[model samples]
Structure formats: structure tokens, C-alpha cells
Target: HASFFHGGPNGSMGFKAIVNLLGIENYFGKTEYNNDADFDGTWGIWDEPFFKFFANKLSSFREPFFSAIFSVSSHHPFKIPEKYTGKFKKGPLPVLECIGYTDYALRQFFEKTKKTSWFKNTLFVITADHATVCYHPEYLNPWGEVAIPILFYAPGDSSIAGVKQAVVSQIDIMPSILSYLHYSKPYFAFGESVFDKNRKNFSVTFTGNYRWIENDYLLLFDGKKSSGLYQYKTDRLFNNNLVSKNPGQVASMEKTLKAYIQQYNNRLIQNRLTPFSDLNYKKSQTKNP
Candidate 1:
């Protein structure tokens, strides 16, 4: 069974659509906006107490269940609860204090769950859907602009505790989780398993044009031809362009990126994202070029 917990009014709209499409149970905190004292008067409920409320509801689920919870108190306007007004220090950005409040809320939720029966066996994966405003120069480029944290936590397992020095995208999370669980089923996914160290994984982002990253280099491709190439590992600012110098690398990366674009658009338009639907098909039969 799968369940989703949404912490705000409008936030639930998108999540509810996904949960309904997947035919799963969902808890929208907006329903409690009228009576709950935790409401921030702007957003729905404050994450501090709402997380505790989420914990109570999560306890009702049976074993072998999948759950997703979203926190909204860290959003815009960035207001904490009345009692926690001066609790968190305000940094250069207004969102910092709000993040601190949500951190406290997550701590409370974890404390409550630690004593629960399923705590030991649960694998918690934390991530953000996208990156937001940047205050630092390091995140000014295309790769850094879309980069968000993806963390895996298993409280009872010491083997899962290590810093991974690999580039991975959010699309890789499902395959990584399945790999960790030793799942042996054949599946179709655009991303590779992060647990497989030998596998070469890359990520693509489109901000007007396509930016693809593999190993240490970042290649920028406009719809027609290759525009720029940079070794992002050494040149964090992306000031130098290697397209004129490295013709072979440009040709290789552009070909790969075009194949990715073709596969993504064709699969999405034709509704053949699954392996079952893609069987007995050839690349020549694809609609998108």
C-alpha cells in the first residue's frame, strides 16, 4: 500500500492528482485548516505540529507500506509559529529560519517514529523536487542551478552510511532503492542505479536549451547544434568553451543528447514508458526524430 501526506492547501492539489492516478490513499492537511490551531494564517498548517499530526496518521498504516510526506512551512513568506518567533536565527536569506523550523519539525517527527514498531526496518529517502533561489556564486551555472540534495537514511543498518562521490539525479532514486532491496525484476527507466559503481550515469537539464553532464564535462546543446562545452569539475563558472578545441567529444556528446531527446519525447507522446508497451518496437518506428 502507498500513502501521501500533504501539509498545505494548494500543495495537496498536485500531490493528490498523483496519488489518485496511482490509486493510493492520501491525507490532505487542508481539511484541518478550519479547526486546527497550527494554521499559519497564510499557508495551511505549520509543519512543527502538522508533522506530529502526520506521525499519528502514519501509525495506522500496516507493514510493508510506502509513504510520502511534504513539508510546507519552509516556503515563501517564511514565517515560523508564534511561539518560535525568535527561536531560529535569521540569516542573509529569509528562507533560512523557515528551513530551521522545518528541521525542528522533522526532528520531532523522527523522535516520535523511533519508538514505533516499523522504525528499524524503514528506509527513508529525502529529496526536493527542484532547486530554488541561489545566494551563492557557486550555484549560478546550469548544473548547480538544478542540483538538489538526495539523501538515503536507514537507521538500523550501518552498511548504508557513507558519502557517495557520484553524480545522480532524482530519476535514479527508484532504481537505486530497488537495487538496495535486491529486486530482480526487469524494468524500464531513463536512469541507472546509483548503487552500481561501474555504471556510467548522467543527468540532463533544459533551461531554454539542453545541458548534459557526464563524468567531469558539461555539454550544452541548442535544438540544432552544439553550442558550448565546459569541464565543470575544474571550471565551476563555465567560462571556457571547449567546443572548438574538442571536436570528437562534441560530436559524441551531441549524438547521445539527441538520442535522449528523441527517446524521451517519443515515449512520452506515444505513451510507451513501460517495458511491456515497448516490446517488439524498433527505433526507426519512433515518431520523434
Candidate 2:
């Protein structure tokens, strides 16, 4: 895993903390950190060099592996490299240009990796940590502000190529990956499998208050009660509060959201995330067993 920040094998927060808690810190062959003085500084390192470093580490590994690379060039203070200044299209926000540069760098990385032995077997999941500056009014609402792309690409197979119209959240990625690997085990997750056609897609977020989206309806809760409801499909701006107009829908979605919040909160407080009492549980257990 190539992390642009949070240096060392075990950082206080982020991915390292989770890995350490799960006792899988030693499982990873290489864990690259950009905060090392050798990289100059976190802001100084660009996408190209970082990706090149990642490619080198990936090529060195002999067995199947899982890796994650987080790019920092497109982050705040969004400075474009002097040599590639005019290479990208400029937009309202400076981050747009930075995004273009990152996109180009990603393409180059993929082009280089395609020739490697590990390229064909890789499953690439691309997503943003958060949404950036909004340019259009349509994307200025709560839903639009939180909207970010989640894409799944399998180089070895084209069977899952088509776009899924159903909404999926970041939490769903882990279950989806496990499902794709045909992992046979009982696990607890707040997210449902994205590949399950019968499952309803939903997402939950908290800014100043809790916001839950299910189907076309969005419900806003103020910890104590649901304050607002909107049908995002019809009212993109969320200008009209449909709490009174759609009582049944509001009640149903509110109940579901409250239940989700209760489950999530209780799980977090109880430290019940792991399926096994010990971290060394075998993955060989059959589905029915």
C-alpha cells in the first residue's frame, strides 16, 4: 500500500490503525509512505513519481497481493507541475486542473502496468475520498455535494463491464470485493453486496446532521427526529421539503434510517466488527460451516 501521508508501519489513525488492529500489519510486503524526508515533503511529491514507485514495488512482489495508492497532488493547494502547466484543461476551481493532471498520470501508470504479469489479474476500484468544489447549481445540494464516483474495473474479465444504475456507497466496496473473490465466511458489515440485484442501494452521511438516501428519497435527521425529506429525483436542489406531502414514504425511510444509525452506533461502541474472536481465524471455512 502506497500512502501519501500517515508515515511509518503503524500510524495513529487511518488505514494503518485498522490493519494494525486486525493484526495483518506484517501480511503486507511493502508499505510506502510519502511523509519520509527522502520524498522531500508530502506536497512536493507528484503523482508520476509516486506511481512509478508503486509500480516498482508491485513488480517486485511474486505472489498475489492487494495494494492501495492514494494520490496527493490533486489535494489542497492544487499546484500543477511547471512542465505540464498547459497540458490540462482549466476550470472554475483550480482542483479541476489538478484532477486532469492526476488523470493523465493514472493513464500513464495503467499503460506501463498493462505489460506486467500482474496487470491482467488486477481488479481496480477507483473512487474519491471526498467531493471537491462544485461548479454547477445542480451539484450544490447536500446529495450533490457528497456525490463522488465509484467505479469497478476488472482487467482480466469483461463480464462486469456494464454500468449499474443502482447507488452504491464506499462501505459497500469491501463486501463487493469479498463477493467477487467468492469468499465463503460469515461477516458483519453495514453495507450490502452491490452485485446483489435484489438488494436496495442506500448511503448514509453526516455533516451537521445525519442524512440518509434510499431509492429516490432523502431524509435528514437531527439526532432526535427527522427534520426534512426530499425526493431528489424530482427536486435536485432539494428546495421543496416533502415531509408533509409524503407522510408514508417519510415514515418508512425514517424508520429504516433510524434502525441503520442504531446498528452502526451500537456496533462501533461494542467493538463487534470482526467475525471471529481471534484475528487468526482460517479463511478455509466452508460457506455452510
Candidate 3:
């Protein structure tokens, strides 16, 4: 996929498999990742401290800069500061350990940025790249669900302030920022604007393995097996697989998910749903997840 935030290796096509299968008009993406990162061993990931750097330093100059940070430390190797090397007692705590550290890093960044003049005027919209691997009873299908987080912070007048209470998705965040700055935005983007609460509060999270949503209810579809059901409102963590339990509701959410899926799906077609990111945060990142 073409990433306006991070550059992709395939450059223009961004690895569009079955490329020729889809008409040229249908195949659209940037030539490569937006740009190359000096510290970026891999091409488009905005790994850890990188986000802090972007937020605290880069944004001051780039008027239209949209910071897309991925916490690398929170990823596989789970590399963290030396100070936290032996921190967790249980051999390794949950992956959330680094995520927790990332939050501290972010807060420190804000503190340093506050000393700068830009802190007051900038609009902050924080969110998670995706959910965690930890599947406690609370997170029900941690195996299948992607609890991507969304946040809103701004040095603006309204819109992104305290908790919105209303669920917001990363997709919706872009348009919200555009609207906040009163910039011209595209009409057909998949995400909704943050302020469009009156519109249906819909969010779709497509991971390589499964997809989930929290509309009026919590629903998950593993791509092949029809769908699964759970009441996300009541089941904060999807403890019970309500698909068999609530056949009626499961059928409805599956229909909604499928209906939305029909709009566009080339990305998911090839199973390239791996998060196009590196760094990640803990609970603080995605407001909801």
C-alpha cells in the first residue's frame, strides 16, 4: 500500500502483488516510503525515539507534517533502555513492558516540547499501531482481535481535547486533523472525521489473521469462517466467543463487517495485513484498545 506517512520499499507500487490483475487505476501507491530514515534499518518504520524526535523537533518546521510513529522497542526483540534491562521479574513481562516505557518516553517528550514554543499550538492525536499479543481473560480473543488505539491531543480550540467518550479510529483521525486545520480533504477515504459522531460510529481493524469491530456490538470475522460474535460494550475483553451463543447478533455484525469490506480490499486480498510499523505503545496509545 502507498504510505503517505512512511515510504515503502516497493516504492511506487508498494509491493502490489496480483498487480497486473488489478487495473492500473486500481493499483495506486507511492514510489517508495515517504523518505528514508537514517536510523531506520528497515525502510518505512518510524521506530521509537523517532516518534519523539518527530513530535518534538520535526513538526516545528514541517507545517503539514503528520507524525506516524511505530515503537520498535515494543516489537519482537523488545529492546529497551539499559535502565530497564533486568526490570521485569518474570523472565520477561508482557510485551506491554516496553509499551509502558514508551509512555514515559512520550510524557518526557511532551515535557521537553512544552519548553519549546510549539507545544501550545500543535494538535496531538495519539493512537496505537495495533493491539497486543497478551490475551488475558479481559481481552477475550487476544489471538484474533487487534485492539488498535486512537487518541486526540491538540493545542487547538476544540475537537481534540479531553476524552471524547466516543470511539475513534486511526482512520478517522486523519480526516479529523484535516478538518481541524480546515484543509481540503479527500471524499472517498475509508476513515471518518473525528467530529462525525452523528454518523455511524464504525471502525474496522483488519489484521493478517482476523478482523474485528465495535459498532453497536463487538464482532469478529476470521476472513474464512463466516464470523464470530461478542458484546464488546459488555465484554471489554472478549472473554466468551459469543458467535455460537448469539447467532442472531453474530449474523448482523458479520453482515455489517462484510458490507464494509466490499467497499475496498486489495490490501487484505494478498494477506499483507502485517502492520506497516515498528515502534508501539502500551494502553496509552490507542484510547480504546
Top candidate by TM-score: 1
Report model 1's TM-score to 2 decimal places.
0.89
What's the count of clashing pairs in each model shown?
Answer: 0, 0, 18
1 versus 2: better TM-score goes to: 1
Candidate 3 has a TM-score of 0.63
Provide C-alpha RMSD values for all models, in order: 3.3, 5.1, 11.5
TM-score of each: 0.89, 0.86, 0.63
Q: Sort the candidates on lDDT, descending order.
A: 1, 2, 3
Tens digits of per-residue lDDT, candidate 3, 1-289, equal 2112322344333335544433322222223224444233433333444445444444445454434433444655555555566653323445666676667667766776766666667777677667667645665464235556676676545644565555566778767777767777333356777776575666777555445555646566776654566666666656667778788776776777776776456435533333331112223346557
Runs with alpha carbons beyond 4 Å of true place in candidate 3:
1-56, 59-64, 83-94, 142-144, 156-159, 207-212, 222-225, 236-251, 265-289
Clashing pairs in 1: none
Please identify model 2 stretches exceeding 4 Å from their true place.
1-15, 24-44, 277-289
Worst 10 residues of 3 by lDDT: 274-283
lDDT comparing candidate 2 with the true structure: 0.74
Kindly indicate the candidate among 2 and 3 with the higher lDDT.
2
CA lDDT, every prediction? Answer: 0.81, 0.74, 0.55
